[model samples]
Target: MAGLPQSSTYVSLTTFRRTGEAVPTPVWAAPDGDRLVVWTRADSGKVKRLRHTARVTVAPCDVRGRTTDEPVEATAVLLEPHEWRQARAALARRYGWQWRVSYASSKLWQRVTRPGIQRHAMIRVRPA
Candidate 1:
């Protein structure tokens, strides 16, 4: 799936379940050489699941008038701060203009309201 174009691509990450199987969440991701990177809230469910397992599935798709799902498995790693910054910069460049808010403002707000104020998680997924 990493070979596919970055646009219109979404990933579905799965973790173990005591019953049958867990439902997969849709994620936007981009490939960085052999690893794939995705951004999400640090305290998101996906991040919590990653602490339990490192395996996941990624799919590249086209929305067209409809949607398609092409699944592939990969082993994931949560990027350290430095790696997250680099990956984020790359993504922002590809996305063109950056988000208007400054990091300092975000930090200040996080110190207050505290919801979704945590750092973003960069999950690196290597093809399995």
Candidate 2:
């Protein structure tokens, strides 16, 4: 990984659609070794895009997805369940109470909206 920002509240994760359109979303990310770990819903559009391609870009950004830094080209991979847990643990260590609160609320929201369908994903991004 090279030139990937670590000191940011959020980052704009840009994923490409099958039509080659860029879709960027601001997300909380924590550095994990040489890569960055991002927590997100399993069915999010970014995950859908990742299913087709690993190519992505990351840049420091605001919560509203406005980029504040140059984008770094990267590749992302969806973690398996066990790896997801490990990756989430890394986020919890980095984000502390904020990660805990967000996790709890997301679970509650899932219960209310999707019933027993609780699914989440951890993305591992390696900058190029």
Candidate 3:
């Protein structure tokens, strides 16, 4: 866990499917105490995969999903909505206006594409 980048802007979040396939994605991550907070779409494949498996691996990566460091074994959990405020606040602090603009844009897009339902979900990752 100590090896995982605490300040990395993009982390390759790899989640396991029920069939044990590894799906890796490049996502924004921000440190929150002992864990990292990741914001992603609610219906993303990674979120669906995590619903069935908690095993995960994370590494610092570029915008293209190419990892820049060795991956660290970890566990991930879907966070409850009540925890989102502070989690998102952490991201906003770390990413500054970019985070705000990106998130607001995502929400707006979601309203147009998938209205009347939550579009974003938060995942908390801890080094195992």
Task: Compute each candidate's TM-score over C-alphas.
Answer: 0.69, 0.89, 0.91
How much lDDT does each candidate structure score?
0.63, 0.90, 0.91
Candidate 3 lDDT over 1-128, as tens digits, reads 35567877899999987879889999999998878999998989999999998999999999999998899999999999998998999999999999999999988988999898898899999889
Ranking by TM-score: 3, 2, 1
Q: Judged by lDDT relative to the true structure, which candidate is superior, 1 or 3? A: 3
Per-residue accuracy of model 1 over 54-123 as CA lDDT, tens digit each: 7776665443312265666777778887777767665554444433244446567777777654566788
Each prediction's RMSD over C-alphas, in Å, is 4.1, 1.8, 1.5
Question: What tens-digit string does per-residue lDDT give for candidate 2 at 15-96?
Answer: 9999999999999999888789999989899999999999999999999999998899999999887777778887898899
Error (Å) of candidate 2 at residue 94 is 2.2
- Please identify which of the two predictions, 1 or 2, would achieve the higher lDDT against the true structure: 2
* Model 1 residue 90 CA deviation in Å: 2.6
Q: Would you list the clashing residue pairs of candidate 3?
A: none
RMSD of 2: 1.8
